[model samples]
Target: MNKEVKELDLIIIGAGPAGLTAAIYASRAKLNMLLIEDAIVGGQVRSSYTIENYPGFKKVEGGTLADLMQEQAQELGAEIDEFDMVERVQFSDSEKIVETSSYIYKPKAVIISTGAVPRKLPIANEEKYAGKGVHYCAVCDGAMYEGKTVGVVGGGNSALEEALFLSRFAEKVILVRRYDYFKGEKATLDEVLNHPKIEVMYNWDLVDVNGAEFMEKAKIKNTLTGEEKEIVMDAVFGYIGTEPKTKLFKDYINLNPQGYILTDENMRTNIKGVYGAGDVREKAFRQITTAVADGTISALDAEKYIVESKRVK
Candidate 1:
C-alpha cells in the first residue's frame, strides 16, 4: 500500500540546535512545518559532557540543554519526527520534496541543519582499534577508561574540552598538539594548563597506535627534531576537527571545496526555496550560539518565501 504524502509549509532536517531553533520560530509564526531527525534529536551536542559558553547558564549538561530545546519546540506546536532517516530529497525553486522511511513530505521550503561529523585520526591501526581504544567522543568512552591513562590529540576547543571532561574519569591524560600554540580559547587553555591530570605536549604528533586486539602504546614524533617515542596508554581520544554532513545534498546544492553548503547571509542557498544552516553550511565559526542565529535567519527567510508564494497564488 502506498502511504499518503504529507504536506507542509516548511521541512526542517536534522533536529540539532539549529533545526530545533528553526522549528520553534516556524511554529511561532503559525507555519505548517515538520522537523525530521535521522538519529537522536540533539545531534553532536548530546555527545558533549558539559557546555559552559552558551548564554544564560554558567554550566549546563549538553543532553539537558538539548532536551530543553526539544521541549520548547514541541510545546510551541512544532511537529517533530525523530529517528526517521531521509532516504531522498528533491529540491527546486518552486517546491521541495523530502522522502523518509515513514512519510514523504512536500513542503514549500526546506531548511538543512544536518551538522558535521568528527574527523578521524590519520594514524596507522586507528580504525582497527576504533571502539577498543581509539575514540572520537570522550563523553561516550571516558568512563570505560577509569583510573587508566589516555592520550588526546589536537589543539582546538574540542580537544581542550574533551581533555577536561576525561580528567574526571581517566587517571592521566597526555594532550598532543602538532603546533606549539593552541587554537582554543584562552579561558579553556588556562583550565587545561592548570589541570594537574593533563600533560600537554607541544610540537609533537601522533604517528601510530600498536596493539594485538586493542591499543596498548602510541608512537609520537617531535616535529622540530627527528625524535620518535612510544608511550603506553589505555586509550586515545581524537578531537582534531569535523567535516560537514552533506553527502545526501551535495549533488543538488552548491557546496564549497570542503563539501559544506554555500549559503547567503540570510541562509538562502542557490535554490530559492532551499536554505542551509548550522555546521552544514560554509562558515568561519560553528558554535551553538552561531548555529542558533543561523536557524533563526533561515526560518524567517523560509517563512517569507512561503507567505510570498501564497500571496502570488
Candidate 2:
C-alpha cells in the first residue's frame, strides 16, 4: 500500500522557539497545522547553559525554556512531530508541499523557522572544549568569567557587540581580529574602543585551543609578523558569525551572500504561501525575543493568507 500524504493548513518546518511559538499561535487560531523537527526543539538556544536577558525570567536554563515552549505548544493542540526531517519544499500555485523521508505534507501555507548555528574557529581540538572554555555567545557564557580574563574572536557587529557585553562581566576582554581593522557598526566600535575593559588586537588569528581537561589557554598568532602567543584566559568566545539552516530552501528562495533567507517585516518570503522566520531570516538581531516575535508575525500573516485564499480547514 502506498503511504498516504499528510495534509495541513500550515506546515512549520522547524520546532525551535520560533517554530514552536508559530505552532502555538497557529493552533490557537484553530488552523490545522503540523510542526516538524528533526533535532532538539530549542535549536541553538539549547547550547546556552543559561539565559538572563530574556524578559519575564531574571534567569532560566535554556533547556528548561525550550521544554516549556514545546509543552505549551502541544497543550494548545498543535500537532508537533519530532524527529522528522524535511527533505524539500515545493511551492505550486497557492499550495506548499513539504517532503520528508517518511511522509509528504501538503499545506495551504508553509512557515520556515529553521534556525542557524554558530560559526566555529578552525582550530585544533576546538570542539572538545566548547562548553568548558570555548563558547560562542558572550551573553550566555560571559557571566561565568566574572572578574576573570577572556578572549573574543571576530571583528563584526556581533563580535564587537558581544565584546562590549562581555566587558560588563569579564575583568578583561581582548578582542582578537585576523585583519588590521574592525568591520562592525561605528557606534559599537566607538563603544568597544572606549570600554576600559576591552583591548583590541588586530592582525592576529586564533590557531589553537590548549587545555588538558578544560580550557586553560588560547594560542594566537600574529598574521603579519608570524609571532605566536598563548594568552592566559579562562575561556574564548567566538562571535565570528553564524550559518543559517537554509541549505535545502536555497533553490526555492532568494538569499543573501551569507545564505540567510530574505523576508519582509512580517516574515513573508517572496513566495506567496511560503514564509521565513527566526534565525534563518536575514535580520539585524537574532535573539529569543526577536525570534518569538517573528513566529507571531508569520503565523498571523499565514492565517491571513489562508483566509484570503479561501483555503480554510
Candidate 3:
C-alpha cells in the first residue's frame, strides 16, 4: 500500500510547550497546521512534579499543564500525530518537506522546537548506574531520594538550580564543581551557596560512581591537588550541561559552534520558509517562559512570510 502524503501550511516538529504554543498561535491565525512528536507531547516539563515558577498558578502539576496545553492546541484545529519521529527535512526555496518514520509531509513553512537533552559526565560507572542511582534531572528523580542524601555535579545555573530544588526534598545536598568559581547567575549562586541544606565542594570532579544495585557512594577528586575522596549518598544528580536536539537539521540549517540553530531576532533561520524556537535556537535564556515567548514570535513571523509569499504570487 502507498503511504499517505499530506501538505500543510505549517509543520511543527515537537509537541512541547514551544511547539504546542506555536500550534495554538498558528491555528488561531487559520493556518492548516500539523504537529509531530516522537514521544509523549509534554517533553521535559512532564517530568517535573510541581511548577511554582510559571505565572498564574502558585503551584501546578507539570503533567496537568502539559495536558491543558495539548488540549488547547487540539481544540484550535491543530492535527497532532504522536509517536511520529521526524527522520529528515528537505527544504527548498518555496516549501519544506519533513520525512518521518510513518509518512512524509510537505508544508509551506516549518518550525523547529525540538529542545535539548541532558549532558552526562565522563565519570566511570556513570551509565552503569543510570537508573540504579545517577540521574540527570532532579525533577524526574528527586522523589526517589526523599529525606536522603544526594550529590549534584556541576556549578552552572542548572546545577545550582537543581541543588536548590533538591534541598526541598532531600535531607542533605552536596554540590560538586570542577572550577572554584561558579558560572551560574549571581543570585542563583548566592542562594545555593547560602542555603543551609546545600554544601559546596569547589575544585572537585566526579571520578567514579560506585554501587551494586543502586548508587551508594561517589568518588570525587580534588582538581587542584589530585586528592580523592568518597562520599556516601542515596542518589546523584547531574546538572552539567545540555545539548540541543538539532541533529536532524544538520544538513539544512546553519548552526552555531554549540550546535544551536542560528536564527535572527524574528526566529527566522537562513532558509526563507524555515524557523526555529526554544532551546534549539541561539538564545540568551532557555527557560520554559522564554520558549513560550519564542513560539509566539515565530508563529507571527511565519504568518508574515506566508502572507507575503501569497501576495507576490
Candidate 4:
C-alpha cells in the first residue's frame, strides 16, 4: 500500500505537558507543527487524579489540566493527532522522517517527547488484576483505594513517595522491597519508614495476585528463606521504575544505556534538526513541570536550527 506523506515545519512526538508546551511555543512562533500521540493528548498527566504541585492553580484535576493544554495548543494552530503511534524515525541530513501507523510526516525539525512507560510486576495474575485493583500511578488511581488497605511494591524514591502520598487516603500501606536496602534518598526513606500507616517489608517479592473480581490478596515470597506468604489488601501499586520509550530511535540517535535519549542543554541530539524532550530525555527529574520546560527549550532550539539552516543555504 502507498503511504501518504506530508511536510511539516516541526513534528512533536508526544502530546503531554512537554509536547503541548512545545507546540504552544512553536505555534506562537508561526511554525507549522504536528503533534502526534499514541493515546490521549495529556500523556501521563491524564492518568493522574489531582495535581497540587503545578504552579498557577492551587489544585486541579489532571484530566482538566490536560484538556486545557490541548485546547490552548489547538487554539494556537497546532494540529493534534491522537491515537497515532509512531512506528519509526529516520533522520536525514536536511529532514527528519516520522512514520506513524497512518501516515508519513517529514519535518525540518523533530522533537521527541515520547515519555516513559510504567514498570510492571512479573508475578502471576498481576496482569489479570490490572485496572481492577492494581495500578502504577498513585496520582492517577490513588483515590479509588481510599480508606482501604493497599500494597506498594519497590523501595525506591517513587515507591516510597507514592506510599507516603497514599497514606493520606488509604487506611494501611504495605511497602515491599526485594532488597533489604532501599535505593531512595535518605530523607524519603526516613519519612516512609517512620509513617505509622506504612509497613515496610524487606526482601520480599510479589509472586502472585489473588482475587475473585478485584484484588483481595497478594502472594509474596521471601527472597532469602524461600517462604511464601499472603497479605490481604484492597489494591496493589507497583513503582519499581520507569523505562523510556525510545525503541524507534535506537538505531538513528544516540541513547543512554537505559534507552533514554541523549540531548544537550538546547534539547538538541547529536544529530542536527533533531531534539528530545520530556521523560524520554536524560534529566535529573521527570515531572510535568520539567517536561514542559523541556518542550519550551526544544521548540526554541528548533527555531534557531531552522534559521541557521536557511542562512547556510
Best lDDT among the predictions, by candidate number: 1
Better of 1 and 2 by TM-score: 1
Candidate 2 lDDT over 212-312, as tens digits, reads 89898989999999999998888899978789999888878889999999999989888897999999999998889999999999999999988877744
Model 3 has an lDDT value of 0.87
TM-score of 1: 0.98
Put down candidate 3 lDDT per residue, 284-307, tens digits, no spaces.
888778888889999999988888
Q: Kindly report the root-mean-square deviation of model 4 from the true structure over all alpha carbons.
A: 3.2
lDDT ranking of the models: 1, 4, 3, 2
Residues 1-313 of candidate 1 have per-residue lDDT tens digits of 6767988899999999999999999999999999999899998889988999999989999999999999999999999999889999988787788998767899999999999999999987977999999999998889999999999999899999999999999999999999999999999999999999999999999999998898999999999996999999989999888999999997789999999999999999999989999999999999999999999999999999999989999
lDDT of 1 at 213: 90
lDDT of each: 0.93, 0.86, 0.87, 0.89
Question: What is the Å distance of residue 266 in model 2 from its true position?
Answer: 1.7
Query: What TM-score quantifies how close candidate 2 is to the native fold?
Result: 0.74
* lDDT comparing candidate 4 with the true structure: 0.89
Pairs with steric clashes in candidate 4: none
**Model 3 alpha-carbon drift over 4 Å, by segment:** 57-61, 181-196
Q: Model 2 segments beyond 4 Å from truth?
A: 123-203, 208-218, 223-226, 230-237, 311-313
